[model samples]
Target chain A: MPQGKPAVVPTDGLTTRQRRNRPLVVLHTGDMKGKSTAAFGLALRGWNQGWSIGVFQFVKSAKWKVGEESAFRALGRLHEQTGEGGPVEWHKMGEGWSWTRKQGSEEDHAAAALEGWREISRRLADQRHGLYVLDEFTYPMHWGWVDVDEVVSTLRARAGNQHVVITGRYAPAALVEAADLVVEMTKVKHPMDDGQKGQRGIEW
Target chain B: MPQGKPAVVPTDGLTTRQRRNRPLVVLHTGDMKGKSTAAFGLALRGWNQGWSIGVFQFVKSAKWKVGEESAFRALGRLHEQTGEGGPVEWHKMGEGWSWTRKQGSEEDHAAAALEGWREISRRLADQRHGLYVLDEFTYPMHWGWVDVDEVVSTLRARAGNQHVVITGRYAPAALVEAADLVVEMTKVKHPMDDGQKGQRGIEW
Candidate 1:
């Protein structure tokens, strides 16, 4: 016998109702050029769908040149382009959020980034209204500044309706294998390897 | 113009020479399921390519079920299935990790997970191998026990020369956006949603 209009049918480890858990999408990549642009583009689409999107630049410290921050931050501002309400908020280092000196031992940098991540996650969890993005997060891990298991576990525990995006290279195998989707950007060509250093606005 | 092999065209931010740097693959998901299986598969493939492979599972604590622990410890027993290695080395979590059950705040959990990520990242960095996998990382983050941003940054920093994967569910958006690959698994139909809960050997 079935109850009156059950929200979701129970199957395996998922419920009909729970199946509606807005899917957790994991995109693992190391390439920045088109990957970052593509991520921002997808984020914009998600925002249009009424998802609250959070943009988190994990490894690119706030101290980076203003040009770099602006370029990345502009991605978040796309919400405005959609004519959505509210503006993209930022949590830069030394501004409410804990700060990490750009120069430090691998351990120190990792510790500071971890602290930054904690703050970002807290804000994302509390917001609960849209999508959250953690940018350049894989940097510290690649450099041995953070723990892969702990980060993976914490991410798994997010409750309520929310979507998160983490960018950067060297994503731990644990994260990639567990992801529902994986888009690898194999470098086909670029101007950097030729000594064409990153330029403001264009390459930052 | 176009000197020295056409300026060493950069693909996805790396030159052909740098392409030697294995692309980092992150497998982030919830629970065991296909996480370990995928890692074993990748390692076997890389091993065939004559590339040294390293597998590291970030066990949050030593309280793993006896059967589960034994099974993981015996992963290398199937080297024949992989066809290229005498035995894959396994590094189980030691005293360098712990979970503070009493600390339930999101911040506390993130902090603990950050510590764990740092510890694991340290080991990964030392290896400098071609492929590495961080399993069950999302467990801590999902439980609010890890710093997601820190984990992402760490992964991004050491991406070059080493391909990595992170596995878990509820993957932070920052991770998905940062990754060169993004995979989303939708439980279109599961037994749990149909009333059949997890079964032994299958779900465990």
Candidate 2:
């Protein structure tokens, strides 16, 4: 159970306490800066400390093209890592998107996104991981598209024993205030306005 | 002439009225999704008008590492689209990061980021691009790192004849509100957290 020590010796080489102290992380979603990479780094760091982890993805609706793209991209990365070469497994929980088929209206989108959040909160509370990355969890709130109260409650419930990371643009003021650490990415310069397009591998 | 017209028409394919109207777009700084790619899509939509365009990139700092990675990943895709070979040309502006000799403070990092922004904005205002993308421009603001008021004023000053895009997280609230359109990317799910590391041609 001790870190860097033989079964009998209590050398100062490493402290088991440090290893056990790795907290859970909940990553709130933001744009494609380095959230995924950062989350991966944290998870990898936790893994090194002998911690068990679980991942959950919440979305407004499964039917949206963007959702599919996000899922495929994330899975593609997962395949490269696990080297298992099988289909990426994700537990899809929540009511499907009703807004897509409904008349395109602000209300419709808001309702659907809110429903998605409730489902995600329910699922997130059920699992335990050293790090929990709530990816893109802010869009609903950012757009006034989801219920803030429900989300706050869910996060509060997981406050203990979980180092959560929430990555998203327009993070709610409340959420920002709650975070122990906050990182914001600012776009300084890029190459695309010059007529460059998104390459499959790099931009996605 | 109107759309779906014959090429030999005397008035040309586009009507005079149509030619005079150019789309207002929010472009990316360099890559797709951030600001550049988004701009490209908008430009492509406008290409039907056959409008003569200008594109400019501000070289504020040398992007040796990010550039190399982007080149390796986006080269093939760029060749296919533009019919040009090898790495995409990236503009490097601004002086690079300046660090304290003894310690690294948050302020120091912010100052460096703002220096980069100042140079980027200088370039954005001087030229006329059908669309302009200010990439990685938010670093200064996100870190509380730069003089955001200046950036906002400069951008506001240059309004018409060009569609501008501000990418990166931590976009100044002033800029976001001023933007006719703001699209934020929230990370909902990622492969990296599932033990997948960054792979070549992906996540670059």
Candidate 3:
């Protein structure tokens, strides 16, 4: 698409600014690596615009955190100290965050994901953020841990100008139908095809 | 693919560390957004790893710069002040960088793009940065302004552990073939499809 120009203008009876300024529900889903990375990039953009960024990461490797977490944390600190950009809050499951999985209570991944979903739902209700990143959220919906219909309805009814971006594989049909923008990251080639192991920095 | 696991392992007779440490030529291409966004996200990861980042943007709209540039510049400043992350250098085709289009001569788009490619080539030879982001570079290749064979060979011959990421639509088949990791961002759905305009912070 051309910069700032929609291919077609709807007769939705809204002004150009109104239509442009409306919040978005962007979904990045498919079998490729850049899903979460792209979502983090959106967070960077949101931070620059002084939009409060809330990232809720779910069911990732328990071993090591992705690199974006540390970078965003630094950005958050920068915002607090110098007020250069917007505020940023990074939350990941299994990290003992206040909203993280209940310790030793929900060992099952599905239940833990469901718990995370509930926390996000509550925050959405309270209008806690301008941009919400549900990184790797599709697994729960795909695995039947989270109700797809419930998610769709909740997002549809979300209050305020909160833009939500969800990244993961197998995004539910209902959620995609309701989303404002969706990109499927498809793999054309991978270093692993040549027996190369994933590298530091680039992979994490 | 599972985290840190390859689907198939080739018999390249190299140690895991050596294979993993090898530099990658990553290409992001297709008819959707998130190409450059994903690349910038990788730059964030690279910075965290103390890898110098060099971003070269080509053929962008003159009206405004993307949000990532400002954020990266701020990160660069952070690194310079506190020895935190890594050094960052952002270069765009216009706006007159020292290596940018030499002002009066290159009136045509192709010539300017060619000049930009030459600058990147020189930087690669110098091993100037650990990670190079060729933002919207495929446009030049697709338009035949830049040579794909030369790009592939130069990247293959590049010294040191330098990772290069090229992003844009309509990537040349040869370049994709040469790339170690290639992601095609396909549009499952777009806000423009619903007659909505792109918004700041999200679109930029």
Clashing pairs in 3: none
What is the number of backbone collisions in each predicted candidate, taken in the order shown? 147, 53, 0
Chain A TM-score for each candidate, in the given order?
A: 0.68, 0.57, 0.93
Could you give candidate 3's per-residue lDDT for residues B50-122 as a string of tens digits? 8999998888563334678878988998999888888999987765444643654545778788878888889
Q: Highest TM-score, which number? A: 3
Please write out the lDDT profile of model 1 over residues A1-204, one tens digit for every residue. Answer: 011243345444655445434445445464423334334434433433445555665654444324323322432344355443224444543333334345333444456677877776676567554556566677766777777776777677667765565566777887675554455544423344443343222222
Error of 1 at A84 (Å): 2.3
Estimate, for each residue in A1-204, the C-alpha lDDT of model 2 and write its tens digit: 001222243344545444233232343334333343334334333332333333333443433223223322333344456532222223322333332343233345556666556655654676444445455567667777776666666766763455565556677877665553444433332223222333222222
Which ten-residue region of model 1 chain B has the weakest summed lDDT? B64-73
Question: Against the hidden reference, what TM-scores do the models get?
Answer: 0.41, 0.37, 0.94
In terms of lDDT, which candidate is strongest? 3
Q: Taking the candidates in order, what DockQ does each have?
A: 0.03, 0.03, 0.70
**Ten-residue region with minimum lDDT total, candidate 1 chain A:** A195-204
lDDT of 2 by residue, B1-204 (tens): 011232232343555444333233342222122233233223222222222222222323333124222322232243345543222223332433332232233344455565556655655566444444455566556567666777667766764455555555556676665554455443333332232223211122
lDDT of 1 by residue, B46-149 (tens): 43343445544454433322223332223333344444233344443433333423332333445555665776677567755656656566666666666667
Looking at candidate 3, what TM-score does chain B attain?
0.93
Docking quality level of the chain pair in candidate 2: incorrect
